[model samples]
Each structure stands twice: as C-alpha cells, then as structure tokens.
Target: MEKTTSLISKKHYPILDGLRGVAAIMVVAFHIFEAHATSHLNQIINHGYLAVDFFFLLSGFVISYAYDDRWSKMTVTDFFKIRLIRLQPMVIMGMIIGAVCFYFQDSVLWPTIHEVPIWKMLVVMIIGFTLIPVSLSMDIRGWQEMHPLNGPGWSLFFEYIGNILYALFVRKFSNTALAILVFLSGCLLIHLAVTSPNGDVIGGWSLEPTQLHIGFSRLLFPFFGGLLLHRIVKLTTINNGFFWASLLTVIVLAMPRIGGSKHLWMNGLYDSLSIIIIFPLIVFLGASGEVTGKYSTKICKFLGDISYPIYITHYPLIYIYTGWAVGSKPSFQEALPFALLTLIGAILLAYTCLKLYDEPVRLWLKQKMLTYKPAFITVK
Candidate 1:
C-alpha cells in the first residue's frame, strides 16, 4: 500500500504551530492597518483580516479534532474538566487583563460599546470570568448581556458549545448528517453577514451576547467544516501536501478578487478555499519537520504560543496606539517601525501572561481532569 500523509497519523505537528504563527501575523497586519490605506501596495497586509476567518475555520477543525473523541468517550465530568483545562484558565486571565484595560482606559473595545449598564457589565464579566457561554440575552432593567472587554472572547463560548454538541450527537448519527448540519450553519452565517444590504452585522457595534444569535449561526459552519475535513482526510489518508499547498497559493494570489464582483460567490469561494488549503498545509509542514528549523520556527512558535493573549489584549493597545499616533500623521518611514513595535510589545505581554496563567492552568487541569474512556470501560 502507498504511504499516505495523515494529520491523524501524528499526535503533534509543529507546522500547525508555524501556521498558527502565520495566521496570527496576518491578523496583526490586518488590525495594524485598520481603515488606513498605507498604499495600494499595502492592501496585502490590510486585507489580512481574512486571516481571522481563516483562524475561525481552522479553530473549528482543530479544537474539535483535538477534543471530540476525548469528549465522546469520557464521562461528563471528565469532558467538562478537560475542556476547562484546555481553554478556561488563560481565557479568564485574558478577561481580567481586558477588564483592567477597560477600566483604566475608559475607551471602547473595538468601538462596539455604545451603552452597557453596571448589571449587564457584571453578567458579561462574570460569564467571562467563569468561562461560560451565555447567549441567553435579556434586558434586565434596560441593561443587556454583552461581551464588552474583548470582542474575540465570545468565540470561545461557541467553541465550547460546538464541543458539547459534537460529543452528544456524533455517536448517534452517520457522518453525512453531521456534515449537512455544519454546512448549513456555514451557509446561514454567510447569508446573514451579507444580507443586511448595508453589510453591517447584527451586533455591529459591540460583541454583545445578542450578536451571537446570528454569530453562533455564523461560526457553526467553520467549526463543522474543520471537524468534518479532519475526519474525511484522516479516513481517506489523503497525503498529497503539494496539492493543498498549490491551492492555498492560488487562493492567496486570487484574493485580489475578494469583496468584489460576484461578491457572495467570490467570498464563499475564498473562505472555503482557505480552510481546505491551510489545514493540509499545516499537516504537511508538520510531517515535513521544516517548522522546527533554526531561527524562524523558534520565533514563530513563540509568537504562535502567545497568540491568544495578544489577540485578546491587543485591541485595547491598538486603539490607544492609533489614537496616540493620530496626530503624528505616521509617515511610511514610521509605520513599519510603529507596527513592528506594537506587534512585538503585544507578543511579550502575552508571553508573560501565558507563563503566569496559561501553562500552569493547563497542566493542572490536564492532570486533574477526567479523560476519555478506554475500550475496557465500554462493552463494545
């Protein structure tokens, strides 16, 4: 039999770490250039916001692939405990950091906060602090449940939801049905994002919990897309890394056409294309072992490791940095330096926090959490 490359074949792939590095940098470029055209040449960096969608698509596949089987076989308490360890500790630290920044800065997080009350603020804070996904939106004395401090934080809630749903349903249905549900979710999200006519999403202003009604609908697709892709590729043993690499290259080259004519068609095409391409490339590079090479991967893995913290904390920093640079006019000579400094600064801060909270918390949780059931436990 011909040897086939499989992400499933390996337990750890550093190239995915490298890919994480790339994806994180793409987001940094996208945000660094926010709304300001550096030059027509700068569009590549500017348009990198697509990276976040790519991250979501990738996350859907990765987190699910990593956790699904574990959840399926483990006891409920074990399942929740593993998830808590995997995600919550660092996430809560991020929330605390964000809250501190919000309190100190008194500025908006992503220009999303219009009016948030003390009670609603308490709820969002408490939910974030406790790491629960609360889309149960309500008006308590005219206050609303919203995600105020960090816009990216809400995605974690949906992530946890996806994990639970997969664990519950994966054992009961055929793969086909699961695929259909996930694909439909992606379609619904695209429809909602574009259908507004004005292009403003439902919670355009803030990362409000209410935004998640549609947002959850939107994220469902990518998460499922990733998970399904992993299962299929692993089962079929599709090993042609070149095929995926070429596809991603072409997609990146063709990105110039994104957000243009045939808007919906083009948008969906690239979005889907990215996921298909990036994940395999990730697997391939990991198998190749190039990601561990001297100098580059070292820095990249470091960046990748710290990505979550930087992502959560950078928004406040960006707002402040941009606001400060507003008067400086920030010429081309200064742009690169400023951007580099901002990115580096965010990375360092994240690294410190990761050491303080992320790693220790993950270790403790893994050691203490319940694990997947071995075959002996089930009478299969």
Candidate 2:
C-alpha cells in the first residue's frame, strides 16, 4: 500500500463527515431511550455508548491526516489554538445551554437542583466553558459528573489530553512505536470493558479514580488506533460511500449488547473488536468515497455541520427528559411522541447555536488569536 503525505492536500471526506453526524444523532437517540430504562441491559440503543469511541477514532484519523505533515510549519501553540478554536466555542455553548436548562430539569434524582444557588450554577458553567473538570464538592448537580452541566464534556476533556499528547510526544513516535502504544491501550480497553460490573465500557462521566481509568481506557485506543490507521492504510475508491458507511455505523452502534449479564467478557470482546477492526474500516470507506449527487452532497454537508454541535449540546435536554421519564415511568408507546419532539428540539437547538453562537465566536477567535496561518485542514 502506498502512503499519502498529508490530509491537507486531499479533498474533504464528505461521507466521513456525514457518518459523524449520523453517529451524533444515534447518541441523542441512545440518551433518550436511556432515560426510559433502568440499566444498559434494557436500553433500546444498548451499544450507542460506542459512539464516543467512534468519535475518538474519527478525531484521531482526522488529526493525523491534517497535522501529521504540518508539525514542521506549526508550533505547538498554534496547534492548540487551532484545536481550541474548533472545539471551545461548542464547549461554551453546551455549558450555557445546560445552565439554561438546568432549573427546568429538577426532579427526584436531582432534588437539590432547587437549593443550588444560581450563582453557583453560573460558576460551574463558567468553569465548564474553560473545559476544566470540577471536583465533586463543587458539583451543583448530584450526579457527580466531572462536568455536571453537560455530561458529554468529559469526552472533550480527554480529547484535549490526546491533543497535548500528540503535540508533546505521540507525533514524534515511529509507526512501530505508535502501534505499540495503541496495542497497550487496546489491551487496557478490553480489560476495562470486560471486567466492569455493567458488562460494558460505559461508566466514564464521574470524577472518581475508577471513572478516570474508564475515561482514559475508552479514549486512548480508538484515538491512537485512528492515527495508526491513517498512517498505514491504503484508501481505495469506493461507491455509495455515505450509504454503506452510515449503514455499517448504525449496525455497529445499534448492535445488541453482547454476552448479556452472564458473560461480561463476551461483550468486552465485542467492544474491543469493533473498535480495533470495524471502526477503521468505516473511516477508510468514508474517506475513499465521494458525495455523488447534489442532494446527497447537501445532506452530508448539513449532517457534518451539525454533528459536533448536536453531540455537545443535546445532553442537557436529556437530563430534563430523564427527570421527566423517571418521575412518570411512562411506557415507550406513551413516551414516543415526546421523545420524537426531544430529538427535533435538540437538532433545532444545535442548529440555532451553530448559527447564532458557535460560528460567530469561532470566526472572531480566529481573527483575534490565529496569528499564524493554519495549513489547510478539513474539519468534519
């Protein structure tokens, strides 16, 4: 297989971008359905948590493709600035959205929501905007999530760690060295996933030591594996790229929970194999295919545009929906209409933030902070 020098030189992979959007949508669905169930065993979208792994893989591949060759021209500060520009705006918006929806989310699970002062929530939201994880004592919400305002912010925190590691260390490693790192991370991931009492790799939101282990275990392998895949794989031209890639992505994400409760390792094997093997295939096919029709191209572009915004912002609403569902214990048939409405509301809210807040904030930041010209890198 021939190796390519830079993702900077290649055209944007529209299908991969769309696949991200698809995965983001699936996450929203998963969270909605998650509200209706007591545990992963009964959750409708049992495998939806794997979407975070998918996001890490996609981020790694894109980072490698875009920056692997530009490190010589780019300083570490510039790279950090670029990443912050791309990500922090959404971080801020997600937190603000969470804060705005926080009071409305009061329920039995978060009974103290009524007692926590507004200034405290604002303080939490302000800290959250910086992408800093708070300790449990400062946790305004009772959930103990590192970012109580927006639970999904934990992934972004790890993503920042990955970026720092890439800038300071990983980028310097040879392919063999990087492969060893990925291998070790994969082993850790498999062990963590299999051994967890829940029979899945889903417990990374809290601030405890064990949850920290889960967070890193989830982040390292797929992110570095993606970087490795970009370094090694030959991209073949493929047809109906978005359709097939999205279909496979949905299948993997929606796959029934493996091994059930009796055999936890069985599910762990499923998680590890999917990340190690299947995800890279999806990225390859997505990168190799083109958006053929005008309508398809538009759809992919829209999906790609909203993917990050949706993922980051939708969970606060999930907190609200979860509170409502837990209080009512509504049947799926009864909840379906409101669930559909929640999905629509989340999308509309994401689009609104994208246009009104995120886009303009990023544009202004780029003008003020991006002193060095970024080498062309397509962001999904």
Choose the strongest candidate by lDDT: 2
Work out the TM-score per prediction: 0.71, 0.96
lDDT of 1: 0.54
Off by over 4 Å in 1: 1-10, 35-44, 67-73, 106-124, 131-145, 193-210, 234-269, 272-300, 325-329, 332-335, 368-380
- Model 1 alpha-carbon miss at residue 68, Å: 4.6
lDDT of 2 by residue, 51-98 (tens): 999999999999998888887777899889989999999999899889
- Summarize candidate 1's per-residue lDDT along 1-380 as a digit string, tens digits: 32322223325444455455556655665666762554333345533544544555566556545655653345556556656666677677766765655545533223323354555656666777765544536222121334455555655666667667766665344579877876677567666655533232323212454465655654566667666666665432334432343345334533543465335454545444444455445543333444334765475457558666666666655655655455466776777788888888777777887788777877676545534422211000
Best candidate, TM-score-wise? 2
Residue 176 lDDT, candidate 2, scale 0-100: 100
